[model samples]
Target: MQRAVIPLKGELTVGDDYTAGDFFDSVSFRGVQLASDDNMLPDSLKGFAPVVRGIAKSNAQITIKQNGYTIYQTYVSPGAFEISDIYSTSSSGDLLVEIKEADGSVNSYSVPFSSVPLLQRQGRIKYAVTLAKYRTNSNEQQESKFAQATLQWGGPWGTTWYGGGQYAEYYRAAMFGLGFNLGDFGAISFDVTQAKSTLADQSEHKGQSYRFLYAKTLNQLGTNFQLMGYRYSTSGFYTLSDTMYKHMDGYEFNDGDDEDTPMWSRYYNLFYTKRGKLQVNISQQLSEYGSFYLSGSQQTYWHTDQQDRLLQFGYNTQIKDLSLGISWNYSKSRGQPDADQVFALNFSLPLNLLLSRSNDSYTSKKNYAWMTSNTSIDNEGHTTQNLGLTETLLDDGNLSYSVQQGYNSEGKTANGSASMDYKGVFADARVGYNYSDNGSQQQLNYALSGSLVAHSQGITLGQSLGETNVLIAAPGAENTRVANSTGLKTDWRGYTVVPYATSYRENRIALDAASLKRNVDLENAVVNVVPTKGALVLAEFNAHAGARVLMKTSKQGISLRFGAIATLDGVQTNSGIIDDDGSLYMAGLPAKGTITVRWGEAPDQICHISYELTEQQINSAITRMDAICR
Candidate 1:
């Protein structure tokens, strides 16, 4: 058995402590809050998803097809294999798996996979449990032990139920929710949360919160309502964190009991009365013309007389390789004096004009030069305008650079930035840099981001694994090419990592036939994986290395018999009768070995032949030699 612990990407904590109001750095396991893709998780937390598995007779090529369409292809060694996390259609269909052996033999089988509306044939149950001591940004002796566990279950009749509870010191909260499909209309969900808190000097307080969510896609109207939500909470309602902070002794909303602290102003904004909130997101498609979307959110607080509101809409389309987009934004603060509004437009055009026409000139390319402009005027009559240009490198969008010039109420300024994304055998990585010029003042900013994975084999550092990943193990098969990934090859340990895998979708991985060693044989040339969300899977391949040779042999100056049997050191081996040209082929030989040939069972009919090889030729494949039997 093997075990490993991996941290999720972008799940770190870097914020000011509410207790002492100081900067703090830490890590969060929020990434694991969802279902994991691998089986390493405990049984109670395992995602109940469909998977395909089988055994190959040798290193063989594997292919899976659904409804006559090839969905996955990969290579595997001679062994039992399993494939999980395949994104498949929710319909009745049989999956076909074909295994092609190195010796030209073919074998195939079928796996049944079908989905029904009333039953959860591929549904899953997932869970997560976290226990840790909360760390604050400051060293003001603020520590709390917290624990949370959640369970998600998908059942028949298009039903999904989820529930969880959390506790921290004198604070506790419980939440439950239910969701179901409405067939062609869409889906809806409802949730309820209850909390109770106790303080050493104050009476116990309890509160409840209610929320509703709705989403739908109108295929006939070409419209999609992505999200619609409404939430309400009582005046006494407090989250677990809020309760814990309120009871902690010596904690203040503003530092040192002062209301004029410069930094405390922003922190104070986070603490507010609980009342109600509404949010909506909707979009529409116009076929070849364009698409548009509208999004908005509003919140009202009980203690504060003012309310907060934000609304935005945008449209985007492409014409003859030129893409265009326009958007408008509006926002109002709870107690702000005036509301703000802005409008922006952007366009992207291919830069092929920079390339001169030649015999090898190509027409449809993706490298682009983009331009964007924005104008804004608020209720106070203040106006602003800004312009920017960007360039993107093609071939998988690995590099992008941008430059901007803007004239705002403050003044004119110019800015430039660049970013790069790369995927390597060990990890994936990204880096970005930006520079700004405001009159005589200039500033430089940069950032670096990546992920790290520690698994059964060891710890590996790379780019974000996204939702799923795979580690390939092919001992002694170093330098093997991994297809579909650019510039990815097996390392010295015959290990290569695929950092990004589509959750619940079929992903193909194959070996480059040209990179194999002549003396070695691979059982399979291709393999496929379907991974669950956030799961790390393993792919194994088998290889064999040995001496291989052919020879021309004669008995007493005459051609050997047609039915002669050959043995290596008295052990029977792969042998074939001499052809019309007096040549025979054999395999599985050892360097400097002896072979005995016998046309009959009698001892006298047996004859021995000896051969020797220099060190250099011993490791060579398909060597031809001549020997005489007397």
Candidate 2:
């Protein structure tokens, strides 16, 4: 579900009034069951998956697989591509990615994947509901309203039962599954989804898809199967997204237009249906020596002969202060002429290890620097080598810079780049410059980012905010630093905003008492807040603005009896009991005030004392004075 409000006549600027325009408020709801292999949920809720990254020398087809199962297949233009949306069959398994270049060359690499078992405690339940309209980037696509709901219940005897359904005007789907906890063996789950759809041509299609997933960890063998799964769908199976496309006008024949036109091609690509997929991700630990991992997948289409495949693995280890790694990638896609493969080696060493013998503090500080090198050779024997140095600058390590030089044997061209990043109290910034000798080409990049929060109290500038934030309010406590924050402090209004607060959980917001002004006192320095998603919660602290006073009161020539009560006549007065020395130490004192002293209930036991503070004493943080009670 989503909602937005647009001002029709007035500008909708931040920190501005929008009273003149009629607002256009819209609320939209839609629910959909994505293809079994696709998951758009956030990483936290979907569990963890390894990101597959690769460089494509030309246009290519990228396929991601795990546990011998192809989980994802897509096309990419020339350049670096990062695949972060791979849906694994299991919770743990290495991912193998294959990139088939337009020239038929293929490259493959392994991404280590591991995650905790997805076993819920007995009797626990998890559920989600979504209501929204069909959404697509293409304005020409048909749209429909839909609803979806899913449920998971942890049953008795280490079993989990899960089911879900999706409903729409023309499409409907239902799914059910069961998962088991195998104790020492591992975990496994199997599910099936049945879907029915009515196309614009009035044709009805019905099908079912079956999936199996497994995960395990062999502690003694040091082998972990993060994910291993397989899925197969019938020819008639069409996801809701696909069903919507089928309902579009002229989607089947492009309105009698040429079959070779771009419009026809778009329709064909959008209608391509999945047939079967296999994925596997695995990793083995070499005890203290290091670790290695392997991941791969294979996928096939329903109508076309094209198939996508990927395989990748790598080994990494550390020796003293030096870290080393070696990896190989292999990829192949049907219709591509040749397979692509790449071999890479990389290492890094801390400069401090070599400079520890020096006694100079500056040199020791610079020891945080690291020297790194990487070399990769393609199947055609083209090699690229890069050397770089990176180091943190400030003592807090909030500022860092790196410089790198590279040489490509294929072009015999040399290139170098330098970049710096700074994480400040209120913002983060980055700058970079890159130049290549090939064409004397130079590029400059820079960025500055921060977050602003507006609340009833006021607007506050802060570091990059997350989904949730907390606004700290401690009036009169200006310039007081926040705990656990880098150089973050309250402004003159004694207010500051802290970002990245976790939703549905308690977040501790604390102030540094030591940083408070001498004349200011805080009744509470810490507060706990729980904010909802995208919510701005206020955390208020009770702060008193006044002087601290230690006053000795006497009746006639003798000091007041101990245990006597003293109360000042002001809103911010600090009331206290007389100490053994006939003096009372109190905070939040006014410049001049009347104090009422009482000990016993008898009428004669009470006395009133009038006291005045000197200019010097009033200006001081702590004032010492004498007072007479009549």
Q: Per-residue CA lDDT of candidate 1, range 388-499, in tens? A: 5566554434456655444434334443334455545555455644443443444344445555666777765545455478877766567777766654677776777777
lDDT of 2 by residue, 1-630 (tens): 111111211111122111100000011223422211112223344435566766554335798754334568986533345577664323344455666754344555545443433455588655544556754434345657776666667899999888878788888888888889999989988878899987656678898888787999999999999888777889888666565664434433323335443322133343346788787888999987999878787778777887667777888899978898887777765444566677778788988655556645646442378998877788999876778888877644678898877776876877667888887767889998776655377779899998777788778877788657899998888888888876477888898888878655688999989888878888788999976545688999877777788888789889999999887776533477998889987776677778888999898899988877777876697888787888
Candidates' C-alpha lDDT: 0.56, 0.68
Off by over 4 Å in 1: 1-180, 198-204, 247-265, 268-272, 335-340, 352-410, 418-433, 438-469, 473-480, 492-495, 501-507, 514-523, 529-538, 541-630
User: Model 1: how large is the Cα RMSD against the reference?
Assistant: 15.8
- Quote model 2's TM-score: 0.72
Candidate 2 stretches with Cα past 4 Å from truth are 1-120, 138-141, 198-204, 219-222, 246-272, 303-305, 333-340, 352-368, 437-439, 513-522, 543-630
Models 1 onward score TM values of: 0.59, 0.72
Question: Which candidate wins on lDDT?
Answer: 2
Poorest stretch of ten by lDDT in candidate 1:
17-26
